[model samples]
Target: MKASEVMADLRRRFPNEPEYLQAVEEVVTSIEDVYNEYPSFEAENLIERLCIPDRIFSFRVSWVDDKGKVHNNMGYRIQHNNAIGPYKGGIRFHASVNQSILKFLAFEQTFKNSLTTLPMGGGKGGSDFSPRGKSDMEIMRFCQAFIAELWRQIGPDTDVPAGDIGVGGREVGYMFGYYKKMAREFTGTFTGKGLDFGGSLIRPEATGYGNCYFLLNMLATRGIDIKGKKVAVSGSGNVATYTTRKLTELGAKVVSMSDSGGSIIKPEGFSEEQLDYIFELKNYYRGRISEVAEKYPDVQYLPGERPWKHVKCDIAMPSATQNELDGDDAQALLDNGVIAVSEGANMPSTPEAIKKFLAAKILYAPGKAANAGGVAVSGLEMAQNSQKLSWSAEEVDDKLKSIMKNIHEQCEKYGKEEGSDFINYVKGANVAGFMKVARAMMAQGVL
Candidate 1:
């Protein structure tokens, strides 16, 4: 299939869904040549089928606050594809959640799951419900209400939904509890459940830890040691916090972390104590990142700013939301002699920023391959649940490391330049993942 023609048709059909369309265009552009080689794939219109989700579930979620006021929010679940295995992805709860965003996320999850070498398909569900400034009881009520509309559509083996953004362990617990009550059977229908109820060890830190592992692989190719490298990681969530922890353990200095409000820069590098404080600030107290500045005299908070442009570092990890890093941010990193960028968030870098990274031939790893550790571990959790047993933290951590290494190797194998040392990880990840899913679809005969 022609990339331009496919993207043009998609644009016409999905006129206002820029995020979903952008995801489609990126994958199709990278895999077009390989896709054209399979005549059966073209005859079956596999590319088109892959671009669209299998089904989308939209419902209204209603919940009551502590004040006895009722609220309504839009909830969605995009089951992108189940060609290889069951649908598996996260459920986000943020004011910004929408069809376009979840569609893009689900589409990206397809390839990300494929790269993990796990038996899973792509799916994403979320609501436009903001968890910020909400009481614990309110959040729990909303989670139950959200799941009430979706429990029937999901199962342990059908579609396993995990946590993302505003939905964490607490949200997952509430939803899973409600789902268990409604279904009247306890199953691993949802991942990221609390450890008390079948959650895997290191599940929260998997994505960040995995990104660091992938970066090590990338850096190792050039015989560069991670010991003395300075890293600027954005976002103060699980991914960002754990990324800092792992980097510090490896002797790298992480200079910054950020949230929606702004960034906190600790140029001397954050201590383990400082990282823990930031983590508790966000995860527990739900305080603004700016509070870090008030607590520590050495830390500087930049209001309404991201850490990329202001920090001079050897590596940059965009652990924040989608499109938070742009071409200008990329150029600034490049100008400051950044050697590598490993995404810990899905699609954190914009198209232009990716192009700049590719043109520069730096060790840039995309989210699909780099940030897949979370889902990889989720797949592990599924396995553990099926076995009715839990693996030790060391065992799970080993598996996570092995998976990240394999993902990095896959990128190297498919993304290696014909004659140059530069590797195009984006093309590699897309092509490799597409090939796997395409072959699976072909074998299944146009379902």
Candidate 2:
């Protein structure tokens, strides 16, 4: 598990694939303990096969905006691996889309899907087109254009896409509508659809609620509870909002929340009414977090700062974008006596930040494992689609809760072996995910 050995092998095998290189590095780092434990994984050349994606598709999406100006965007679909089943992941619509990021996400999705123990493979697709501030008609046009090409590459039995960062319920609805029109099928080819369609009831809250469920399990290991604890959460989107709601429901006082523009600190705790108003501005009105301060003068808004820095909390959840919390932020949270950190977004913490949290012995949960709920529920959606039946909201929520608990147990089972009381979630997630795919690959034999 030496870095030199890993780098050498990776370079020799995937000389031109930098995405493969980055992914291999992360996978190796996460499961170095597993390599040390087994050694045969290296001997059998499993790393080489796992490093290469099963398939990669890139295309151009040309759409006309409301102004009748045509815009060109790059689209990607990386089917990282399909050993378990069909490709399953979200289609992110952001200006930051690229092959490297998609490859990394698809690679990560492989394990994330595996962690759910569902019959799903790993794949992701999207365009480098941002949907922010676009008119509903413009978005619909863009979605239609995007799906015109993407529909040929995906389906219910082949690859299914849900919503990601810039993609939401509205986008999903548009895309699904376009797919239905183009394919002349009412089948469920996507998740996160409107409830009127095949969408699950708790899909919006799945990721955040699942993350809290995992954190609760982590705390339970030490006989700790979330009741009456203080929490600071970043991001006002679905993940952060739902995390706040679930935490509040569990008797936690979430005093801080933020958006991309700025952070809001309410020392008295954020009321559900205030949160609903914030959601109204951000989600409905598509405004900034500063609007929260304007609406409720009681809430103090801090400009140009992360919420974690100003709030002292027992739990800190970075549900924001990737690497939003860095080393300094981790140190600040640790110094402020934050007991636990769970990522509700992919790779929300930088390597240095995670190292700092680990060094401080804080309970940290990585996004791959903690935020798998969205994809897990997506898999469930797929099941319902295939079975031509829809589960009730309560039933879906019960299933989601059970899956989160199982994921936590799996993490603890593998993470506790190294005498780390807090659990090495990275190791746990990677090992658990790797074993399932590894076994499937072995059974498939040289594909």
Candidate 3:
């Protein structure tokens, strides 16, 4: 199938859903040549089927707030594909959650999971329910109501949901508790559970830690040391905070971190002590990232602008939301002597930005390959729950590092140009993941 023709068809069908269309386009374009070699796939129209989700479950969540007021929110679970294994992905709870966004996420998750060499397929679910400013009781009520409708459709072997943007340990606890009550048997139907339960150790830091590990692997190919490298990172959430912490441990200066209100561009980089304060500020106080500037004399907070605007580092990690970095942002980064980018958030860069990064031949890594650490660890969580045992922090961390190295190797193997040393990791990751899923789908028949 022609990549342009397929994308045009998808665009016609999904006119206003730019996110979903962009995801499908990226994958097909990268692997178009490989896909063309499979005549049976073309005869069966596997590309089209792969682009569409297997099923989408939509429902409403009704909850009572602390003030005795009732609220309604829409919930969704897009079980995109399960050719490799059970449905697996995170459930987000933010005002921005929608079909297009979740569809893109699930599509990315499928390949991301495949790259992990785990027996897992891709899926994504979430609701447009902002957890911000909600009381604990209110959030608990909402979680319960959300799972009341979702529990019947999910199980350890059916569909496993984990935490995402607005859903964290607290939200997972509430949802898991409600699911246990509704389903009547306690099983590992969800991940990111509290350690008292079946949650895996190092799961919280898996994504960030894995991202840094992947970066090390990429840099190692060029014999570059990570120490003393100036970096810029976006987002103040689990991925960003832990990534910053890991980089600091490796002697890299992370110069920026941001949240909804704005970003903190610190030319001097953040000390480990400073990151600890940010952890409390965001995880406990639920305060804006602007608070970092307020607390620190050396930090600069740029309201209404992304950290990419002020980035002057060798590496940029857009760990925030989708499309947070655009073409202009990418150009600004390139002009500032940026040489590498590793996405911590799903689809953080737009098509235009990705084009510029590719055109400039920078060492770029997409979220699916670079940030699969969280889900890779989640896959480990699944295995531990199945074995009825837990691994030590060191064991889990070693396994995560190995998995990331393997992912980096796979990308290199598939992404290397015929004569050039530069590797197109996006193309490598997409092709590597697609070949696996496509073969799996072909073997499984038309389900």
Candidate 4:
């Protein structure tokens, strides 16, 4: 369980996959006790098997833009593992897409999917094509072209992709349409679709709602309550919006919300009407957070800084992109008397930020565990599609809430350390996920 031992083993086993090695090292170092408890995990060569992905497919996507100019983008599908079931993850579309990030995400997905207790493995796919500022027709053409090459590699029973930061319901619809057209079959090959077609209710809100549910469990452990507590959240995307919605519903005063460009803080708390207007600006009009301050004279917009830097609150949720919060942000929260942080995005906090939170004994939930709700609901969507049934909004929301509670319990059960009030969620999540997949792999006996 020592850092040296973990690094040595990782380096020895995964010499070529630096991304996979870094992820494994981080999770393994946190849960070194698990390896100590089960020494055979290392002896039986499980680490070697688990460190490498089962398959990685790379292809070229050539599509035409609105200007009749063709562009080529690289796409990848990293099937991390399928010991439990078929691969499941989301497809991201952004200019920053790269093999290392995708592999890390896929590696994280393996454990995230396992934490849901669903029969899903781990996988991820995406292209470096940025959808921002593209016309609807241009985006559709890119999606169709991307899926034309992707369709041969994915299916309902094989690898099902959902939405991520850049890929939303629109991208899902476009991809699904292309898949259906090329394959000439109606199948639940993808999730996060329009509910009238094959999507499940509450899919859009699952990640945000589940994040609050997880934080609630963490608070319950210490007899804390979110009611009347001040909360600061980053990002105005689906996760942040729904997180704000649920937090406000639970009697928490959400004082701040931000997007990529800037952040806005309202001391009087954002009203439902104000939130509705902000939602319209961001979701409907694709506008920036700076516009919120102009529309609502009461709100204050802080330019070029994250909301976490200036807000004082009881709870802070980093719902923005990866590594959005760093050591300085963590220190600011700690200085402001923040108690808990639940990640709504993948690796939103840098390693230094997480270390600071852990050192301060604050409740910190890692993204892989906290943000698994999206994939969990996506898995449910796949189930409904396979069964040809759609669950009601309440039903789906209830299921999502239950799943979040279960995930929290699992983390608490495995992540608890003696003399530490702060739970080791990273360890809990990684080991719980690894145990499920390892047992499945053992049962199958080396495929």
Q: Provide the RMSD of all predictions against the true structure, rounded to 1 decimal.
A: 0.8, 2.1, 0.8, 2.0
In candidate 3, how many Å is residue 65 off?
A: 1.0
The model with the greater TM-score, 2 or 4, is: 4
For 1-447, candidate 1 gives per-residue lDDT tens digits of 899999999999889898888888899999888888889998999989999999999999999999999999999999999988899999999999999999999999999999999999999999999999898899999998998899999998899999999988889999999999999999999999899999999999899999999999999999999998889999998888888889989999989999999998877788778888988888778899999899888899999999988979999999989999999999999999999999999999999999999999899999999999999999999999999999999999999999999998888899898988889999999998998999899888867
Compared with the true structure, what per-residue lDDT tens digits does model 2 show for residues 139-251?
88888988888787788888888899889999999999999888888887899988888888889989998999889888888788899888889998888888888887899
Residue runs of model 4 more than 4 Å from their true location after superposition: 1-22, 419-422
Q: Provide the TM-score for each candidate, comma-separated.
A: 0.99, 0.94, 0.99, 0.95
Off by over 4 Å in 1: none
Model 4 pairs in collision:
none
TM-score of 1: 0.99
Q: Relative to the true structure, how large is the alpha-carbon lDDT of every model?
A: 0.93, 0.85, 0.93, 0.87
What's the distance in Å from true for residue 166, model 2?
A: 1.1
The ten-residue window of minimal lDDT in model 2 covers 14-23
At residue 32, candidate 2 shows an lDDT of 68
lDDT tens readout by residue for model 4, 223-319:
9989999899899988998898899899998899988778999866888888888777877787899998998889999988898878798989989
